[model samples]
Target: MASQLNSGSDLGFEADLFKAADKLRGNLEPSEYKHVALGLIFLKYISEAFSAHYKKLGEEEYADQEDPEEYLAANVFWVPPEARWEHLQANAKRPQINFTDVNTGKERVGDIGNLIDNAMDSIERANAAVLKDVLPKEYGRPQLDKTMLGELIDLFSKVGMHSADGKSKDLLGRAYEYFISQFAGAEGRRGGEFFTPRSVVQTIVEMLEPHHGRVYDPACGSGGMFVQSERFIENHQGRRSDIAIYGQERNHTTWKLCKMNLAVRGIDADIKWNNEGSFLSDAFPTLKFDYAMANPPFNISDWWQPQLEGDVRWKYGQPPAGNANFAWLQHIIHHLAPRGTAGVVLANGSMSSQQSGEGDIRKAMIEGDVVDCMVALPGQLFYSTQIPACLWFLARDKSANGHRDRRGEILFIDARNLGHMVDRTRREFSTSDIATIANIYHCWRAKPDAGLGAYQDIPGFCKSATLEEVRKHGHVLTPGRYVGAEDAEDDGVPFAERFAALTATLEDQFNESDRLTALIREKLSMVRYDV
Candidate 1:
């Protein structure tokens, strides 16, 4: 999303805005400051949408502008009078006074923090279905600075979230996305708990081409997958209503972030949250999705393995008690529609590890013809951990999707050498890199007349391996073993000539070593005589 805001040599307006906002965060941790700033941004987006709709309804012949359903019908969250950005901004610098809470009747001082908290509560009450328990109402906390809260609201008031022609809405969406990424980076390892790298999410969306269907993510962190998928559809000139999104996240805070993220983009999704998580409490249990994408926590040791000992989702095999890699794989597989295709990000070990029957589960999935493709990713692509990762493409019926029939073949792409370093400790896939990888998969899967061009194996890069070839390697799915090393360039020297030169060089080095040894011994002997 930050990529969209750049204009050649300039960092663009959103980047500049985020920098200014970060500067106002004096003595506040990014973790806490993010909630404050993002809450305001979310409020701004919905209020603008409501105001636009309200204006239209007022111009109508006999429309009721005050009715909440009028805004709800247009897919706009109804921002009550007290919760509107203008109201909050108007009272931003209000002096402290005795205030009574309507719900609790608790007498409190009317400061900027209390006013902001009340505004958040009013918004939630007006639109409970979408905003219930999602908006952060912690601005009144004693630790937060009231003056800074008012200043932050004033800062966001300058952001033009809506325009008469409605072109600025897209800009606002991009800015929201950029802010999410910036916050994720600032939060470091904790950030990865709620955000996936934008490039990685883009690559997954490009590969799946989830153009129109039910898309789902079991561990939907901040709903990045849904955002990217929406972008893909919009970029292709498709209608947003064509796709339905479903997601589940264990973390309540991240779930609220996901809700706000999707709401700001005006993408309606059924994102559920609970403490039990997707593993133990399977939300959306009987539903199957057409496209599923997830970056589940890698190598998790406590995924309620004992509680789910005989779960039906473990059709491939029971995952080891000490690891949940196979469990995640099977859960995704179980939730896939008959024609569903999924792209999963997992630790590289999932591609070849044999520990605790993971290899057998992999073997079963491969033999079942569900494993479509495996791509080894470059390192430093994640903010959470530095563990090398890979993408596992699973398709329930690859042969039926107007694609070439290759049921027994799996595509292995060794992309460990692909992405470029973005910083000292991070790497990202360039536009060309993402296109190159996605195009390879498309070509390999497209039918002859599909216009994606013919697929061919490139040494040390990609290979279409047969099941027999896979079995020979003990069902190990690491791409390197199958793709082989890239061929080296010839230096115009004959093999015999090179061998002769190497041996000659070795002989001269040996002779030099012998002379040095004799010189050292003679020196030692002279020193002994002196003693």
Candidate 2:
């Protein structure tokens, strides 16, 4: 296990950058400042990308340097002249601002905030298809301090955001990820809504290995799942173009964040947003995906369950109207392709709860042979809630795909003791912890020739249990039930010698007690005689 938290002075450039940006946050709450800071970072990223492409187009005789289509064709967001980073940086120190609205021909006078707001607008208008309403345009709000905003812009400007030809796209992307994580930590519960902790996301991506085909997340908060899946492909030397991305986010602000988060990483996704959410709206309604991963709002009580009766996604069983835990599970299952696999994060109760037919649904899913594995994770891994959670891994077709036929088997991993505390309140899986868990799954699912080692049951850590064993436990999916207690270490002393020593100690204690009793009786008799 390893710790990810660092002191202000120890965390290198990103940490120092975050601290500097936060100082300028003065009166704004983290919730508000999050948009302010992240919006600028996103703006800087696109501008750099556009500028790098613009320089190349300028050198080519046949290319139109100013053509928006040229940048769009290369999957780059076109930044208009007024919206470029260089222009913004140059104007950061302006004492007074004056600009004419291109659409209305109206003169606007304010400060740097107005300039940034306009820049955000221009970028959106220029790349309407990809960025239509994604960028935040509220920098001109009255509560924001102009001086701090200017300084913040200047601070970001000093950072070398681009290489000569934009080869450092990932550098900015990584920084953006770090910022999102930090903001989540700052915002606490609300932050967890938009961001899944990186370690947890990495574990899922590594286990699923979404190398190709379509990947989807119905509750795609800030698109962390999609980002990690793309990174997984790149890390493993797989072509990112092999997989298409699809997602839906109900929160309007979070939806915008997801779009920018993906765009910064050069990932094209069909991420949709609707107030009705995935349940009522069903954004990717008719599409089946090769892989689906999500960390939906846990145990949501007001998921509009009264309106979801007889919903087509409830193939296993109807989820209780009060809690949407089972609803999320069935929804993910519904969207899985014929041979698709899925990994989902849910409350621990979902694994063993018998309330409102949830247990029955688990039974049906188990009997159907769709449940592949269940991992019981440690607590304190989330910024959202303190509730312990588990990972549910499902496979649509287990007996096919050149893997061993695992129809009646399920792997249970009790990882509640694996991770180390990163801080006083938070815990995260280290690189080694993630690799250990993923290796178990891969070995269990892979063929012998795949080069992953053969899977073996480690007592109290992992166990491959038969369906009958699951049924014997009354359909409870808690990993501790199947994996059993870990074996205790053996001391050098033999059992006979240990027992003899214990008896000797007990005899000495008995003898001492009898001597004390006799002395007390003698003292009492002497007192009686004297009386």
Give lDDT per model, in order.
0.86, 0.87
Candidate 1 regions off by >4 Å?
1-11, 97-109, 486-531
Candidate whose lDDT is highest: 2
**lDDT of model 1, residue 33:** 89
Q: How close is candidate 2 to the true structure, as a TM-score?
A: 0.88
lDDT of 1 by residue, 21-61 (tens): 88888899988888988888888888888888989999999
Top of the candidates by TM-score:
2
The estimated TM-scores of all candidates read: 0.88, 0.88
User: How high is the lDDT of residue 330 in model 2?
Assistant: 89
Q: Supply candidate 1's per-residue lDDT for 118.
A: 82
**Clash total of candidate 2:** 0
